[model samples]
Target: MARNKFDVDENLEVQFNFGHLKRMMGYVKPYKKEMIITLVLMIIANAAGLLSPYLMKEAIDSKIPQSDKMGLVVLSLIILATLVISGVCMKFRIRTMARVGQCVLENIRRDLFVHLQKLPFTYYDSRPHGKILVRVVNYVNSLSDLLSNGLINLITDFISLFIALGFMLAINVKLTLISMIGIPVLFAVILALKNVQRKAFQALSNKQSNMNAYIHESITGIKVTQSFAREDKNLDIFREVSGEYRSSWMKAVAIQFLIWPSVENISTLTIALVYIAGVYSLDKTITVGVLVAFIGYIGRFWMPIINIGNFYNAIITAMSYLERIFETLDEVPEVADMPGAVEMPEIKGDVEFKDVHFKYDDDKEILKGINQRIKAGSTIALVGPTGAGKTTVINLLSRFYDVSSGEVYIDGIDVREVTLSSLRKQMGVMLQDTFLFSGTVLDNIRYGKLDATDEEVIAAAKAVRAHEFIMELPQGYNTEVNERGTRLSVGQRQLISFARALLADPKILILDEATSSIDTKTEITLQKGLETLLKGRTSFIIAHRLSTIKNADKILYIKDGIITEEGSHEELMAKGGDYNHLYNSQFIMLKAV
Candidate 1:
C-alpha cells in the first residue's frame, strides 16, 4: 500500500487577475435585466437612506424649536415612510440579486463541468481528481456571495458613502475636510495589507485542495488500509493534512480580522476629530441642528467605508477563486479536433499505424516508430511485458493522446482529422481495473448507451454471462453497485464491464487485460461469449496469459516499445523467438503453480 505524502510546503502563487474578473462578469450578460432592476432598487434604498439625515435636520431646526406639532408629525411620518421604503427596496433588491447571482453561478458551474468534459484525457492524467473537484465545487461556491450580495452591497455602500459625503460637505466643508484626512490613511493601510491577505487566502485554497486529495485517495484505498491494519497510520496522516488546512484557514481569518479593527480604529479617530470640529462650529455659521446632522452623515460615511473594506476583503478572496478557476479554464486540450474537422461517418474499423512515434516525456520514448495495419474485423492480440507499450497502442488507437509524430488512421481517415466525439462514440474500451459508478447494475450497463431500454440492458448482460449472478441479487439488474463496484466481486465487476462494452456494440473494441480478474470458469464462459462478440468488430486484446491469445488471428510480441515478433501462437512457438520464450516461461510457471 502507498502512503500519501503530507507536504503542505508548496508556495501558493496566484494573481488577482482583472481579465478573469471581466470574463466571469460575462456570465451576468444573460441576467442584465435582473441586474438593472436590482441596481434601481439599490439606488432607491440609498436615496431613502440619504433623506433620513435631512429629515432629522428639518425636525430639529424648524419643527421642534417652534413647538410646531403638525410640522414635527409630518417630518416624523416622512422619516418613518423613508425607513419603510428603504426596507422594502433592500428586501426586493436582495431577492433580485440573489436570483441573478444563482443564475450566473449555474452558468459558470455548467461551463466549468462542460469544459472539463471536453478537455483531453492528458489534462486529467496530469492533475488530481481532488484539485479538480475543489475548483468545480468549493471554489465556485465561494463566488456565490461575491456575485450576489458582495456586488449589490458594494454598489450600495459606495452610493451611500458618496451621498452622505455630499451632504457632509454641504453642511460644513471645513469639518468634512478634517474628517476626510483619515480616509487616505485607511486606504493606505488596506493597500499595504492586500498582498498579505491574498497570500493567506491562496494558502487556504491550496490547503483545501491538498486535504481533498488526501481524503479522496485514502477513501479509495480504504480496503488496502483495513487489510494491512494501517488505519492508525492513515489517521495520523489525515490529522497532519487536516491540521495544515485548519492552520491555513486561521491565517486567512487572521488577515480578515486585522482589516476590521484597523478600519474601525481609523473611523473612530475620524469621528472624534469631527466632534471637535462640530463643537468649535457651534458658535459659528453652523447651527446646532446642522452640526448634529453633519455628525450623522459623518457616521454614515465611515460605515460605508467599513462595509467597502469588508467588500474589498471579499473581492480579494473571490479573486483568488477566479484565479484558480480560470487556470483550469485556460488549459487547452492536448488532443482537440482541427478547424473544420469533419465528423466521421460509420467506421469500417481498418486501423493502421503509420510510423507512429510517441513519448509522454522527451527524456524517454514509450513507443518508437511503430508501424502496423489491421484488416477490418480482425482480432489483434498484443502480448507484451509490463511497460512495453501495449496500453499505449490502445490509447493511440482511441486517440486519447495523439502520437508525438506520425498518424493513426481508421478507415483511411486520420484519427486527428475526425471530430473526437464522432470517432470515440464508435469505440468501446474495457480495462483490467473496472470502475463502476454508484448506481444500479442496470444503470451502470446502460451507461454504455444512455438511451438503452431495460430489456436491451438485460440482453447485453445475458450476452456477457452476467445475467445469472445479477438475477441472484436482491434487485436483480436493479441492485445497486457501490462506488467502484466494491459491492460486487472482482470477477462480477469485470463481467458487468464486459456487458457494458457489449451493449455499446462498437465497431472497435479494446480490452486491456479485460479478464484478469475473472475466475477460470468465468473466463471459460467469457471466452465463449467473446467468440461471437469478436466476429465482426476489430478487437485489440492486451493479455498477459499466453493461452488467451492462442486462437487470436494474430499476436504481436512487443518488447521495449518494439514489436519483436508477430504471428499466430503456433507459428511463433515454432519460430522459437522472443514469443516462444515468453510462452514457455508462462506455461512452465502455470504448470509449477
Candidate 2:
C-alpha cells in the first residue's frame, strides 16, 4: 500500500547507463535518412564556419601588407559568403532536425501507450496513476531533443573539433600544443562531476514524477476533498511535493550551470597562454597574421568542446527519463494470451468453476477451493458481506485474473485456452462504479458494440429503461456528457451502463451491484427491462437488495472465501442458515422503514 502512494518514488537509484542510449537508437532508426541529411547540413555549416578565420588570416598577412586592395576586397567577400552559407545551412539543419524530433516523439509515445493497454489491473493497482502518466507524457517528451538533435550534435562537434585542431597544428605546432594545455584539466573537471550530475538529475526526475502524481490524484479526488473539507490538508501536501520538486530542480540546474562557466574560463585561460607564448616567439618564421589566425583557431577548437559538454549534460538528463520510459516499456503484461491460443467459439452461457483457489499479490486467499456449475441460460444470484469473495468469483469467470488453482470452463472449454478478446467479447460485465467516457449519450451506449447502429443503440436504451431519462435531456440520445457522466445522477449513470451492456447482447452477463444506485421506483421499472435483457442469457447478479435476487434460479450466500449456502429464495428460507438471516435482516429493516 505504501508503494501505491503518490509521494513514493518508484525508482530512486537510477545509475547512469549507456544501455539506455543504445536502446534509444532503435527509435532513431526509422528517421535515419532525415538525420543523415541533417548531419550533412551540419558538416557543411561547420566547414563554412572554419573558413572564416583562415580567410581573415590571408587578408591580414598577404593582401593588406602588399597594399593589394582587390585582394582584400575579394577576401572580405569570401568571408561574407562563408557566413551566409553557414547561416543557411544552420537554418535548414535546425528545421529538419525539429521534424525528426517530433516524429520520434510520436513513435515513442505511441509505443508506450500501446504497451500500457496490454498491462493488467494489478499493474495499475500497485502504483500511483500519476507516476505512470508522467512516464508516458513527461518522460517520453524529454527524449525528443536527445533523439533528434543530441546524437547529431555529439557526432558533428567531434568532427568540428578535429577539423579545427588540424588547422591549428598546420599553422604552428608549438602554439597548437600550448593551446591544448586546458584539455586534460577540462576532462578531469567533467569526469569528477559526471556521477554527481547523473545522480542529481535522477533525483530531479523522481521528484517531478512524485509532484505530478500528487497533482493528478488531487484533481481526481477534488470532490471528495471538498466534501470532507480536506482542501487545506491537500494543499499542504501539494506544497510539500512541489517544494521538493523545486529544490531538486535547483540542485540539478546548479550542477548544470557549473559546466558552461568552467569551459569558458578554461578557453579564456588557454587563449591568454597562446597569446603570451606567440608574443615571445614572434619572428620571421611565425608572422603576426599566423598568430592571430591560430588564436582564432583556438577559439574554434574550444567551441566544439563547449558544445559537447552541453550535449553531455543533455544526455545525463535524458538518461534519467529514459530509464523510466524503458522501464514501463519492459513491463511484461501479467495477463496475456497464451501462445497458439485459439479464438473462443460462440458462447452458449455454460460456466463452471472447478475447485478454484485465488489470492492477490501473496495476500490471504480471496477465493478458496470453490466449486460451482451453472446450466446454460440460468440466472445465479451471489449474496455476501463486503470482502466475502462474491466479486472475485465473477472476476475469475471473466478471466480478469488467472486462478491460483483449478479451472474455469465456459461452454466446456477452458477459458485460459482461448484468446482474451474473443472470450471477453462474448460476456458483458457491469461493475458497481459505472464510468462513462466523454461523449454523447448515443455514443456511450454504442461503445459496448462499436459497429452498433443508431436504432440498435436506441432499442438497448429502451430495453434498459434509460431512454425516458435520456429523452428528457436537452438533445435526448444526442445529449453530450462529460467524463464519468459527472453531471448526471448516479442512477442515470448506472442506467446508461445497463444500456451499454444490453447493446453488447452478450451470451453471459455479470451485474455487480448494477442497480444499487437506482431509487426503488426506478429499480422496479428497470426490472421489467432487465427481464427482457436476461432472456436466453446466463447471468450472475450480485446485489445486497433481497428484492432483486429473490427470484433468481439459484442464490449463493458467500462468506470467508467460500459459499456457505446455496438454494432458491424459498429453499434458503427453509434452510434457516446464513442466507435466511441475511434475507430476514433486510426484511426487518424494510418493515421498520
Candidate 3:
C-alpha cells in the first residue's frame, strides 16, 4: 500500500484564497467586445423594468379610474411593448453570456491541461492524479460560475435597485425614503458578513479539496488494504475525512442561513417602523402602487448588498485558484534546450560519461564522479547495491534530469549542449515497469514511431520473437490490450515493450531491470531478443539476475555512488575484489537453491 503522502494542513491554502479573482478576469480580456455587446443588451433590459411600476400605476389609477377605452388600449400596448423589450433583450444578453462563459471555461481548461503536461515529473511524484484533477477542474468550474452567473446577478440586482428606487421616489418621495431606512443597516450587515463568509467559504472549499485527495488516495491503495486485511482500518480513516468534510459543509450552511435571516429581519423592522411612523407624522398622500414598489425595492436593494457580500468569499477564493494556474503556466520546464543548442549529427552509438556527478536533491549525493565510456555497438552493465545510483545514471543519460556536475557526451557532443528533443530521440528506454495503453498490439508497437508502417511493425515483432505468440492469439496484432495491457502476461508485456523499443531504432538504449518480472523460460527467450535488440545500439543494462548481462563488454560495480571496479565478467571475477565477493555469494546461493 502507498503511504500517506500529504497532510491536511498542506492543502488548506488552496481551499481558501485562490488569489486575485480580478487578476484572473484578465482571461476574459479576449471576450471584451462580446461583453460590451452583452452589457448594452442587459442595460436596455433593466431600463424596461423601471416601466413596471409606472405601467401598473397607469392601469389602476389612470386607465381603470378614467374608464376611457382608447386610453386603456394605449396604456396596455405600452406595457406590452416594455415587457417585449425586457424579454427579447434578456434573451440576447443571456445567449451572449452563455457563449462567453463556455469560451472562457474552454480557455482555462486548455491552459491548465497543457501546463500540466509541461510540469516536471516531481509534481506528479508528490500529487495523485485524482487530487490534482479535482482541484484543477472543480476550482475552474467555481471560477466560471462566479464570473458568469454571479457577475450577471450582481449587475441585475444593482440595476433593479437603482431604477426601482428612482421611480419610487418620483411617485412618493417621503414613503420611498422611509422604506429605504434600513438600507444602510443592510449594508453594515453585509460588510460584517463579508469577513465571516470569506472565512466560511474558505473552510468549505478546503474541506472539499481534502475530501477529493482522500478519496483518490484511498481508491488507489484499496487493493493493498484489502490484501492486507486492513479494510476496516482504511474505512475508519475515510470516515474521519468524510465526516470532517460534512461538518465543514454544515458550518458554512449555518453561517449562510444566519446571514439572510438577520438581514431580512432588519428590513422587516424598518418597514414596520415606516408604516407606524407614516400615520403619525405626516398626512402624505401615498398610493398603494408606490408603497408596494418601495417595499419591493427594499428587498431588491438588500439582494445586491447580500450578493456582493456573499460573493466576496467566492471572488477571493477564485483569485487563489487563478494565482496557482498562472503560477504553473508561468514556470519554465526543467531541461529545456539551451539557446543556440545544436542537434548532434547521427550518432555512431558511442556514449561517454566523464566524471558524472548527480543527485535528485541537494543534500544527498546519489552519484559522485562516476566515469564510463562505451564504444559504438557495445553492451555495458551497471551492477550495484540498492541506492547505488544505477538508475540515476541512466536517467541522466536520457536527459530526464541534467547531472548536478560533470558531463555526459554522445558521440563527442556534450549532451547538455544539444537540443533536448534531438538528443533524446537517439535513445530508447524501457523500465522494469511496462506502460501500455488500451489499444491493439499493432497500435502499441506503432507507438515507438508514429509513422512506422505495418510491415515494419511485424518485422520488429518477429526480430524480438513476439510475432509467434502474437499470431497464436485470437486477433493476432489486432488483439485489444486493456488498460496497462493487463490482458497480457508480465513476460508477454515485456516482449511487446522490447519490440517497441527496437522499432525506435535508436543508437543508444537503456534497459533498466527489464527482465526481472518475466519467468526463467521467458527470460531465456528474451535474452535472445536482447541480443538482437542490442546488435547496433550502445546499450546500458541494469538487472538483478546478473547472468543476463554477463556478456557485457564491460561491467562496472558501483558502491556509494562511485565505481569501485570495472572489467569484463572473467576479469572482475579474477580480480577478487568487491565484484568477486558478490559473484561468489550469488554462485553459493544458486547452488543452495
Candidate 4:
C-alpha cells in the first residue's frame, strides 16, 4: 500500500525489506511435503555423486597397487551403476519439484485474481491494469524458478560440498585446509557481484513491465495510432524502452560471467601454493588419488558459491512481488456491509438523498450537500453542462463509491446498511460508454441475467429494436461480437446495452446518455423501448438531448455539484429559472440539427 512507485537505482537494483520477504515465505507452505521428499532425493543424488571420487580413489590406490584386475572392473561397474541410479533419481526430483512449483504458481495466480475482484473501485481508479499485470506475471514467475530449480540446486550443492570437504579432510587434513585458502576470496567475489546481478534482474523486470504496457496500449488504440500516422514513431519509442531490457540482460550475464573464471583461477592458485608447501616437508603422504579427489571437491565448492549468489537475487525479486500480492490479498473490501447488516429490503423505488457530499479526490469535490426525494415510480431527468457532476449522482445511486458525507436511502433503508450485492441487484445501469465482451449477442444480453432464456433475450433486444438489425447479420443472436464489439457501430452497441439492462428487470434504472451516440432515427425508434424499460421503475436519465426526457416527472438542473433548480419541464419554463435559461439557450441548436 505504499504510494511510492518503483524506482530503480544507479545500479538498477530494487530493494526488498525483511517484512516483504517473510510474508513471501508463506507461499512455500502447500508444497512442504513434496519439497521435503525432493530435498531427500537431492541429498541422496548429491551424496552418491560425491561418492564417485572416493570410488575413483579406491580404484587407483588399492586396485592398481595390487593389480587386482577383476576388483578394478567391478569397482568401475559399481561406480557407473551408482551414477545411473543417481541420474534417474535426480530426474524424478526435478519432475516432482516442478509440479510443486507449478501448483504454487497456480494458486498464487488464482489468489491474486480473486483478490483483485475484491478491491475497492478507487483502487482500480488510481492504478493501471498493466502495472498490476506486470506485478502478477513477473512476481509469480520468479517464485516458479526457486520452487523448481533453485531449491534443488541449493540442496544438492550443500550436500555435495559437505561430503566432498569431509572426504578431502579425512585423507589429509593439512592439504584440505590449505586447499580451502580460496574460500574467503571466493566469498568476497560472490558478495561483490551479488548486488550487481540483483539490480540487473530488477531493471529487466521493470523494463519488461513498461514494454508490456506499451504493447497493451498500442493494441487497444491501434486505430488512433494509425489514424495519426504514428506507428513508426511508436515503434521507435518501443525500441527505446526495449533497449533498457537488452542492457539489463547484458549486465546480468556480465556479472554472472565473472564467477566461473575467478573461481577457476583461485582454485588453481590454491592447489599450486598447497603442493609447494608440501614439497618442502619431503612428505610422500599426499597420494595422487587424494589430489584428484580434492580437485573434484574444489569444482563442487565453487559452483554452489556462484549459484548461491544468483539464488539470493531470485529470492529478493520474488519476495518483492510476493509483498504486492499479499498486500492485495490482505485488502479488506471497502463496500462490505457491517457484520450485523441486513440484506436489502424489498424496495418500492422510493429514494431520498439527504445532503450527499462526494469527492473523487480529497481537494476536488464532485457532489456537494445535495438533497432530493423522488416518488416510488417517478422518472427524474438530470440536466447540466459537461463536468457538472450529474453523472456522479448516478454513480452514488448505484453505490459505486460511498459518499464522503451524507445518506442515500432506498425504500427507507440506508444503502450502506444492506449487502452490496443485494443492493445492486435491484438497480440496472447503462453507462455512456458501451462495453461488450467477446461473445454472441445472445450471450451478451444474457450477461445481465445469466439464466435468461433465449426468448427473453430476443424480447429484450426487440424492445430496444436491436433484434431486427441483429437478424440482418449472418448469424443473428449467434453472431460473434469481437473485442469491445468493434464490428458494431457505437449506437448499435448502446442498443445492446439497453437490452441488457432491460433484461435485468431492475426496480431502478440509470441511463447514462444511453442514446447519445445513436442517430435521430435510431433514437426515435428506441423511444418505445426506453419507455417500456422505464415503466414502473424509479429512473434517472442523463443526456445532452433534452427532448428525450420531455415526459419525465421532474427535471433537476444541476450545477457545481448542487441542484440549482427542480421542476417539471412546463413548471421550470414557467418559473423562468436556470432550467428555462438553458432550454432557451439550446432551442436553436435542437432545431438546426
Candidate 5:
C-alpha cells in the first residue's frame, strides 16, 4: 500500500546474499563452453608470464657467468614466444567473453520488459516509473563487466597467486615467508571497511533512483509546471535531489578509494621486508640471482592480490544492482489468469453483476453490493457524480480488478474463470484519457486490431466522423503523429480513439467519458454514427452530459457505492429522484450557456 514518491528510497536488503550469485550463474550456464575456453586461455597466459622471471634468473646467474652466448640467445627467443602466445590467448578470451556479455544483457532486458508488461496497474501506480527504468537500463548495464570478466578474473588471479607463491617458496622459503607478512594486515583492513563500503554503495543507489524519479516526473509534468509558473520551485526541488546524489557518490567512492591504496601500501611494505630478510639471512647460499628472482615472484604474487581486491569491489557494486533487478522480476501480478482458466467463447454480451462489492483498499469501500443485469445487444448508461464508483463498475466488469465479494458474469460464465486475453479481446474500452503512440494516423487506429487493413481502418474512422479531419492533414491517413497524438487537438484525439475502439469490432463496448472533449457540432455528427454502431452490440456508456444518455435503454444513477436510481430518462424524471435532479441541474447550466 506504500506509494513511492520522487524523494523516497525503495526498501532494500542491506545484508549481502549469496543467493544472488547462484542465480547469476544460471545466466552463465548457457555459455559454459565459452567461459571454459576463456578460463583455459587465462591459465595459459598466466603460465607463460610466470616463466619470464625464472628465465631471467637463469640468464643472469647461469648463462652470463658461464659466458654461454648460445644459451642466452636461445632463452631470449623462448621469452618472445611466451609473450606472443600470451597476447594471442588474451585476444581471443576478450573477444569471446564480450560476445557472451552482450547476449546475457539482451536476455535479462527482454525478461524484465516482458514481466513489466504482465504486472497489474496497481504495481505501476505505487512506484515512480523512473525507479523502474533505472533498474532495467542502468543497473543491468552495470553488471556487464562483472558477469563477463569479473568471474574469470577472480579465478585466474587466485591461480596466479598460488603459482607465484609456489615458485617463491622453491627459490627461497625464508624470503617467501617474509614477503607474505603484510597479507594479514591487508585482510584486516578490508574486513574493517567491508560493511561500511557496502552500506555506502547502497545509499548511493537509493539516491540515484530518487534523483532519476524526480527528473522523470519533472519532464513528464513540465507543461503543468510552466502553466502554473512553478519553474523556480521545481528547479529548487531538483537541485536538492541532485545534491543528495552527488553527496552519496562522494561517500561511496571515498570508501572504494580506500581499498587500492591499502593493497599498494601493503605490497610496498612486504617487498621491503623481503629485501631486508634476504640480505641478512643465515643461509649464506642465497645468491644475487636467487634474491632477484624471488623479488620478481613477490611482485607477481601481490599483483594478483590487488586484482582480487578489485574483483571484490565489482561484486559488492554488482550485488546492489542485482537486488533491484531481481526484486522487480520477482513481483507477482495482482491480476492474472486463474489456474485452469478457459479461453472465453465468442461473447454474446449478456453481463450481470450479482451483489458485487469492491474496494481498492480495506478502509474505503468503492462499490457496495451493487447488482445489475443487461440483456444482449442492450445499451446501458451509468450516470453519477465524480468518485461515485461508476468507473469501478466497468473496471470490475473488464476484470481490471476482481470484486471483493460476489461475482460478475459474462454470458453465465464467471469473468475470473476465463483467460484475461480472451475476455478482454471481446470488450472494447475507451478510457477518459486517450493515448496514441508515435505513428501514422492509420497506425494508431489499427492498434486496436493490429492486423486490420487500411480499408477497414478508413471505414471505422469514417463511421466515427474522424475521416474528414484526418484527410485534411498533410498526408491524410499516412501523416505521422507524435506520441500521445500531441499534434492533434483534444477533440481530434478522442475521435481517433473512438474510431480505434469501433475498429476492434468488440461485442461489448465501454465508453467512459469518451465524448467529453469533443465539440457539440462533432458530438451531433458522432451521435448519428453511434446510433448505427450500437445496433447489435452491448454498450456501456458513462457520460456527464444527460443529452447523450437520454435515449439509452437503461440508466443507472450511482452515488456513494450504491445505485440511487435506475430507469429510463422519462421514468427517472417522473420519479423526481436523484437522476431527475442531476439532469435538471445540467439542463439549467446548458440553458444559461
Candidate 6:
C-alpha cells in the first residue's frame, strides 16, 4: 500500500448540509418529467379533496331545507366521484415517484462503486471495508424514501393546506383567522426541535457505521478469535458497539416523535378556539352549514401541518446520510494518470532506480538516496533483513507508489510518464501473501489471462507441477476452491498462484518470498519451473532461503535501507560480508532443525 492522505478521525462530524441536497438534485434531474407529472397528479388529487367540503355545504344549506331530491342526489354522486378520483390520482403519484427514486438510487450506487475502483490503493488502506460498504449500501438506502416520497408528499400537504385555507376564508374570514391562531406556535416548536433532531440523527448514522466496521472486522478474523478462545471477549466488545448504536437510534427517534404530539396539541388548541367562536354565530350571519364546513376544513388544515412535521424529520435524517455519501465521493485519488501520459512501449524489462527516496510519512525515510540499474533478461536476487526496503523496491519498480524524489525508469523511459495500465499489463507479481478468488481450480489459474484456453491453463499448472495434486482432488480442475482458497493448504495455494503468474507470460516477473510456504520436494519442483519461467525475462526474487537465489546473475544484500553487499554467493562468502554472515546463520539453523 502506498502513502495516502486519508486521516482516521474518531469523532467524525456530520451536519445537515444544503449543498449535499443540491448535489442529489443532479441525480433527480434525469427524472424531471416523472416528477412534474407526479406533482400535477398531486394537485389534481388535493383539488378533488378540497371540492368535497363545498358540495357538503351546498347540500346542507340549500338542498336539504328545500326538499330538492334531484339536487341532493346529484350532490351525493359528485362527492362519491371526487373521492374516487382523489384516491386514483394519489395512487399513481406515489407509484411514479417511487420509480423515479429507484432510478436515482441505482445511478448513485453505481457511480460510487466506479469511483472507488479509480481511487489509489492507499485510500483503501486508510479506511475500513465496512465503512465503504455502509456508504454504498446503507447510507445510499437511507435516502430512498426521502427522494421517493418525502419531498413530493411535503409539497402535496402544503397544497392541501392552502386549498383548505381558501375554502375556510371564503366561508367566514373571522372564523378562518381564529382557526389559524396556533400556527405560529407550531412553527416555533418545530424549529426548536429540529436542531436536537439533527444532532441525534447524525450521531445515529456515525454509530451505525462504527458498528458495521467492527462486525466486518470481527467476522473476517473469526478464525483467529476462536483459535485463541477470545469469542467471549469479542462478544463483549460487540455488545458495547451495538449498545451505542441502539442508544443513538432511540435518542433520534425520541426527538423525531416529539413533533407529532407537539403539533397535535397546537391543533387541538386552535380547533377549540374556533369551536367556541362558532357557538356565538350559530343562528346568525354564519349558518349551521357554513360552521360545519369550517370545522371540516380545520381538520384538513391541521392534518397537513402534521404531515409537514414528519417530512421535516425524514429530510433531516436523509441529510445526515447524504453528507457521508458525498464525502466519500469527494476523495481525490492520490495516484492517478498524469494528463497526456504516453502509453508504455513494448517492454524490454530494463529497470533502473536513480537516487530514489521514499517514505510513507514525512518524518522518516524508508529508502534513502538509492541508485541501481539492472539490464534486460537478468535475474537479480534481493536479500535483506525485515524492513530493509526490499518489498518497497519492488513496489517502486511497479509504480504502485511514486518516488518522493528522484526517478524510476523502465527501458530508459520514466515510469511516471507512462499510463498505468500499459505499464502494469506486462508485469507479473506473485507476493508472499497468496490470494485466490472463489471459483473452480481452472478458473483461478485462468484469471492470469482471461482469454486463456483450458489447454493453456493445464500447461501452466503442469509447468509449476501443480497438476498432479489438483487431479487428486475430487473434481480436478473443476473443483470449487472456496473463498481465499481456504480449502487448500498454504503450499498448495502458493503453487496455484505461481501457475497463475506463469500463465500471464509477462516480460517482467517478481517473486517476493513466493516459495516460502512450499515443502522441500515442492520447492525443488517450483525451482525448476522458475528456471523455465525466468528464461529471457527480467526477474526480481526476494527470498529468505539463500540456496534458491545462489545461482542468480547478481545478489544484493541490503540492510538499513542500503545495499550493504552485492555479489554472487561464492564472491560474498569469500569477502566475509553481511551476506556471508546471513548465509552462515541460516545454514546453522537449518542443520539444527
Q: How much is the lDDT of residue 168 in candidate 1?
A: 83
lDDT of 6 at 389: 92
Candidate 2: misplaced stretches above 4 Å?
A: 12-16
Per-residue alpha-carbon lDDT of candidate 5 for residues 1-593, written as tens digits (9 for 90 to 100): 54779898788844458997898888888999999889988998998899888999899889999999999999999999999999999899889988998898888989999999989888888899999999899889999998778888899999999999999988987888888889999999999988888888888989999998999889988889999999999999999999999999999989998999999999999899888878886358687788888888899999999999988888888878888888888888878999999999999999999999998866699999999999999999999999999999999999999999999999999999999999999999997788999999999999999999999999999998899999999999999999888899988998899889889999999999988888889889989778867779999999998898988999999999999899899999999999999999999999999
lDDT of 2 at 444: 96
Query: TM-score for every candidate vs. truth?
Result: 0.96, 0.96, 0.88, 0.90, 0.96, 0.92
lDDT tens digits, residues 277-346, model 1?
A: 7888686778888988988888899998999999898888887788888877776777888898999989
Q: What's the lDDT for candidate 1?
A: 0.86
Give candidate 6 misplaced runs (Cα > 4 Å).
1-9, 13-16
> lDDT value for candidate 3?
0.77
Per-candidate RMSD vs. true structure? 2.0, 1.7, 3.3, 3.4, 1.9, 2.9
User: Compared to the true structure, candidate 6 yields what TM-score?
Assistant: 0.92
- Candidate 4 stretches with Cα past 4 Å from truth are 1-15, 125-128, 194-200, 256-283, 316-342
Q: What is the per-residue lDDT of model 2 for residues 38-117, given as tens digits with 9 covering 90 to 100?
A: 88888888988898788878988999889999998898888888889889988888888888888888988999999999
The lowest-lDDT stretch of 10 consecutive residues in candidate 6 is: 1-10
Among these predictions, the greatest lDDT belongs to: 5
lDDT of each: 0.86, 0.89, 0.77, 0.79, 0.90, 0.87
Off by over 4 Å in 5: 13-16, 281-283
Residue-by-residue lDDT tens digits, candidate 3, 1-593: 12234335234323324344555677778988977777777777777756766776666666677787888788778778888998998888678777888788888889888878766666677555665776568867867767666666667767777776777677767767777777787677667766676566666665666678877777767768789999888778778778887987887777667666776687678778766655554435755554555555555555665666556545655654554455555656776778889987898987889988887765688988988888998889999898898888888888888889999988888888988778778789989989988999999999999899999999999999899899988899999998789799888888999999999998899999998898878877777878899997789999777878889999989999999999999999999998888877888898898
